[model samples]
Target: MPWKESTTMEQKIEFICEWRTGNHTITELCRSFEISRPTAYKIIARFEEEGYEGLRELSRKPRGTHPNATDEMVVGGILLLKEKHKLWGAKKIHKLLYNDFSEEKIPTVLTVHNILKKHGLVSPQKRLRRVKPIHPIFDPKLCNEVWSADYKGKFLMGNKIYCHPLTIADSKSRFVFTAKGHYKENLASAKAEFTKVFRKYGIPQQIHTDNGSPFGSVAAIQRFTRLSYWFIELGIMPVYSDPSHPEQNGRHERMHRDLKAACAKPSAHDLKAQQRRLNSFVKEYNHVRPHEALEMQTPASVHEFSTRPFPEKIVRFDYDSELKVLKVTRNGSVRWGSYNWVYVSASLQGKHIGALEMGNGIWRIFYRNVFLGFLATIYHLGQAKLRSNLI
Candidate 1:
């Protein structure tokens, strides 16, 4: 009855020592040791036949070698391909060889890994820790409803400075619209690329990005940057990932990985060469690469230009009679009453904002429909500090 997890040897010793007493029945001994009758018998017989060594556990690994395993000639073939394309991984190698050899004849990605390890071409990898998924919440039922945008980290070209890549993709289809190298990571360069993508593919309902510059700001209220304000002006809602959580925009991050491997590993000679590489990658990724999440279909097959075409000119915001409208001055302050002045964002200078009441004479402000911030409009002398909270 003293079943223990001390060691395999300890359990076996206990079982044998108890069995030697010859007082208990087989079923009783099996139950006492927390083992089946068959298992108990097998252990007893092994100890009797082969002594203490027999009680030790045997490997469950297959005794015979794999039937379709690569022999010396096939190993030579793998090495030859590896020598030819040194950077190609096992999966890529397996995909390459799968066509030439019969499915049963060619080795799998795992087998390829083993061969590489046997040859000292690769080291054994440590088990990766499992992390919780931070998948972005927006699920577009159809293509072009939600789009993702991010700047893939900068890399140096043959040019003197670094080049930042601005990548954009359709959320539903995973179609990468563009992955252009930028001379600067500032707004002007980003807007130029975005304008081209907008003009080409049309506008989406929302654009998801991380809480970073160009797309967002840390100091700004709601982290809405001027670039995001522009997106809002164009009838696009901007969504942001939680801070330090890259996996929230995981699909885009995965694309960035492929982009790094394909184009930026050994970066191109100049901006122009990098642009050419990106163009090639985009063509292959959209029209050729089969995405597993997309049921192994190409993104190009699923994506089409959005029906909500980009407007040539900016559309002015309209306020209904239900809300009190206040015009923002050059200094980004609204002259709320004869004496009261509420400050809005400098980005909203010369714009109109609607004031929505939130009870107790506390007014929440809006640039168009976005909730900017709050104001106690009745001018409680004690609440002068509340004005600083408005942006």
Candidate 2:
């Protein structure tokens, strides 16, 4: 019979009394109590050692320190580091511990976490709900294969000016190229910052960004903005994540999160001060911070400068002999069928485009080597339908 919770003490007393009477064997007592022989022996041993005091329920809590518990000195070191970098967690703290503590002396990451947790220094965070990688994410093997850039969401500074931080990082090594604070997200500011980065880091094969202004346009052909067109002119391709899906460019987004935490939470007084803070963040991120993806290696140690140098002057694009070439007018339209003007993007004004006639009144367009889209050349009521779905 299982012992009732209310009658547990009574049952223990009855078992002891029955044993004292010598009426029941150890097995019989265990059977009556629905407990093992070892439990009966333990109860009897405690009774023998301390009489009725032992029969009263003893504390279930552990009496002394565990054998595998972290040493007091090591706990002090962990707490000190946590005090220094309150934002950092156990993994980063564990890595830093090697500077002062030997590998044998240092505790595991979990142990360090428990040390922080025990002292109420760190709170348990809800586990992130993981989702499947539904969208295709491009992972570059080389440093300059792709670079990701974005404007970290605008935040107000102490001086009451809204600061827009533009951050660019190498896709493979996560090496931050630049993090510039701008007054606004405009073409001139973005172009100036990018020119500086391009001249220093050289040109990447491709640049990845979200569907945002100065980088891409929803209405334009192939989502090419003036900035992206410039990339095309430099023989660099521009790529983008799908609209409303930030996780497609998750690595860059993750960096933005860190940037906001480090610099934006306690915003600087002015743009100049904000720029200084960004510079510090870039230095620490590239050189000091150890990335888990890179096996805890710093980004600066892994990244290499691009081989393609930024040209002083952009070379003009030449088309093949078979295609008909025409320059886009100031109004961003081409002369079609001598009278009908097919409207392209105004951003493509003064640029030359080539049109190759495909079968069935369809004409395929191209800017340099990149295919713009398909255009139906049959002039119906002075209107030419442009089909940009091929992209």
Which regions of candidate 2 fall more than 4 Å away from where they truly are? 1-73
lDDT of 2 by residue, 1-391 (tens): 4565866778788888998999889998887778888888888998899885687876898879888777788888999999987777888888888888888889999989988998899967899888775754688988899899999899999999999999899999999999999999999999999999999989999999998988888778999998988999988999998888878888999999999999999999999999999999999889877789998888999999999999869997779999999889999998887668898889889999999999898889998998889988766787887788563
Top TM-score hit: 2
**Model 2 clash tally?**
0
Tell me the tens digit of each residue's lDDT in model 1 across 301-379. 9898899989878898887777789887888677866777776766667778898776887777676777777776655
Clashing pairs in 1: none
